[model samples]
Target: MPADLSHIRQVMEEADCLYSEAEVEAAIAQVGERITAEMAESNPVVFCVLNGGLIFAGKLLTHLRFPLEASYLHATRYRNETRGGDLFWKAKPEISFIDRDVLIIDDILDEGHTLSAIMDFCRHAGARSVRTAVLIDKAHDRKASPDLKADFVGMSCIDRFIFGYGMDYKGYWRNAPGIYAVKGL
Candidate 1:
C-alpha cells in the first residue's frame, strides 16, 4: 500500500530529531572540505547514487570549491520498503570511468550492499580510483559487507529506522529538514 500523508505526519511527529538542519549542514560542510583536500587535484567525477543521494549531493557540491564533473547512478536495494533485497539498477553513469577518479555519494551507508556494488561497477568500468561518501553512517555491525565502509562520512547514526535529510520511510520524508530516528520501529 502507498504511504498515506497522515501516516507520514505521525511518523515525523513521533521521530526523534537526531540532527537538526543546521547540524546536518555543518557536517556536510566538513565532508565537503575533506573531499576538497583529498580529491581536488584529482578531478574526480562526483557520482550521486540516487535517489536518496540527490539531496546530499546537491547540498555537498555547493561547498566543494574544486573542478569536478557530476553524474548520477540509480541503483536501489530498498524499493520503498524497510527491508532490503537484491540490487536493481535503474540507471548508470553515462560518462566513461576509464582512468578517472570516481566519487560515489549516497545518503546513508547501512549494509554496504548498494555502495559497494556501485564501487565495484566503477572499477569494472576501468576507473583508476573509486571512493565512497555518505551523509550518515549507521553505527552497527550488521553490514552485509562487513569490511566495506564510507571514505567520507558526515556523521554516525544510531542503528535504527531513520528518515529525513535524504533518508526516507517507505518512500516518504526524504525532505524532512533534519535527520530523525523513527520511534517504535
Candidate 2:
C-alpha cells in the first residue's frame, strides 16, 4: 500500500507544536551535561536505539566532552504504527559491552517496555552498568514497571501521540524540526 503524501502533509499542518526547535535543543544540551557529569569517566559504550534514537543521539553525542564508543541497535515495537506489539530486533549490539558501562539513548520513554528489555539484555550480556537517556519521557501512570525510569531525561511531555526529532507518526514526520502532537491523537 502506498502512503498518501497529501495526508502526511496535512498531519503536520494540523498538528500541535509541543516543543519548538530551540526548546528541544536546550533540553538536549541539558541532558548532555548531565550525562557527561555522570558517565564521562565511566568509559561507557553508548548505544543509540535506532530509527527513533538517531537524531537525539547524534545531537547529544556532541555535548559529551569525554571519549566514548558510540554504536547503534535497531529494536522496535511499533514498527511505524501508533500502537506497539512484540519486540522486533532489526539489529542487535554487535560490539562487546562486557564489563563496561552501557548507555542506551532513545527518542522517548513511553511505557518503558522496550527500553526495559534492552537494559535487561545489557545486564545479561555482562554490562558493568546499564543506563538510559531519553529525549522525552511521557508522563503517564501505565509504565512497564513502577520503578522504570530513564537515568537521564531531556524533557517530559503529556501522554500524546507525538513526533519529531526522531519520533514518527505513521512512519513519517520523524524529521520535523520540533516536537508535535497529532491533532486528535
Candidate 3:
C-alpha cells in the first residue's frame, strides 16, 4: 500500500510544532553530555530502538565521545498506526551484551511497555546493567510500571499524538523538522 501524500502534507501543514529543530538539538546535546559523564568510562553497549529511535540515536551518539559499541534492535508496538499493540520484534540484539553495561535509546517513553520489556530482556541476557534514554517523556500516569522512567530524557511533552524526529503517524512524517502534535489529537 502507498501513503496518501496529500493527507501527509496536510497533516504537517496543520500540526502544531511543539519544539523547533534547534530546541530538539539543544535537548539532545544536554542528554548526550549527561550520558557521557555517566557512561563514558563504562564501555556500554548502546542499542538504538528502531525505527523511532533512529534519528535520536544518530544525533545522540555523536556527543558520547567514548569508546562503545553501537547497534540496533527493531521492536515496535505501533507498526505505524496511532495506537500501540503488543510488542513485535523485527530484530533483537545480535551483539553479545553479557557482562556489559547496556544503554537503550528510544524516541519516546510513552506507556513504557516496550522500553521496560527491552530492559528486562537485557537484564535476563546477562547485561551487567541496563539504562535507557528517551528523546521525549510523555507526562502521563498510565505506565507499564509506576516506577518506570528513562535514565535520560531529552524533553517532556503533554499527552498528545506526536510525530517527527523519528516519530511517525500512520507510518509517515518521521522526517518532520521538529516535534509536532497532530491537530486536535
Candidate 4:
C-alpha cells in the first residue's frame, strides 16, 4: 500500500461524504450559538475529550462569546491500534469543576461509552450541571447501555464511520478541514 492516505482511504471507502470547509465552519457557528444560549455564564468549564475533540473545541471556542474555561482528558477506545478497542480512562483533568457547569465535547457520538463515563465522572466531581456536545450523533444501539445523550447535537448521522473536522482514521485525517466519509477501510 502506498504511504499517503492508502490505509486511511481504504477505511473510508464506504463513508460516502465530502463536506466542504465552509459547511464545517457553519456547523461550528451553530453549535456555538446553542452553547452561548443554553450554558450559563457562571464559569462554565468546557472539558474536551481529546485526540478528536481538540479541533472541535478550538473552533467552538472561537465562536463562543461568554466567559468560559477549558480543560481536557484523554479517553481512548484505541490504544495505538486502528480499531476501537477497550475504552480506557487514562489522563484525567486536574482542573476544579466542583459545583460548576461542565460541558463535555467530543467529535462523534457513537456507542456513547466514553461520553457516558465522562458524564459519570463529572457527577462524581460535584458538577452542578453536566451536558454533552458532539459534531455527529449516530443511530446508536439503544440496548448498548444507556447512552450519554448529548444536550447539543450538530447533525444526525447514519451509523457509519466518519473522519475529518477533527475526526480521524488510524490517527490520520484529524487535520482534514472538512468532514469526509471514506469508501472503505
- Quantify all predictions' global Cα lDDT against the true fold: 0.90, 0.94, 0.94, 0.79
Q: Per-residue lDDT tens digits of candidate 3, residues 15-84?
A: 9999999999999999999999999899999999998999999999998989999999998776777787
Candidate 2 residue spans exceeding 4 A from truth: 77-86
**TM-score per model over all chains:** 0.94, 0.95, 0.94, 0.84
TM-score of 3: 0.94
lDDT of 2: 0.94
**lDDT per residue, candidate 2, 15-79, as tens digits?**
99999999999999999999999998999999999889999999999999899999999887778
Candidate 4 wrong stretches, greater than 4 Å: 1-5, 9-15, 77-87
Clashing pairs in 1: none
Give the runs in model 1 whose Cα sits over 4 Å from its true position: 78-86
Off by over 4 Å in 3: 77-87
For residues 1-185, write the lDDT of model 4, one tens digit per residue: 44566656666554666667787788889999988987756679888888788888888888778988898988776676776656677888878889999988898888776677678878998999889889878775752477357888877666556788788876787887777776642
Q: What is the alpha-carbon lDDT of model 1 when measured against the actual structure?
A: 0.90
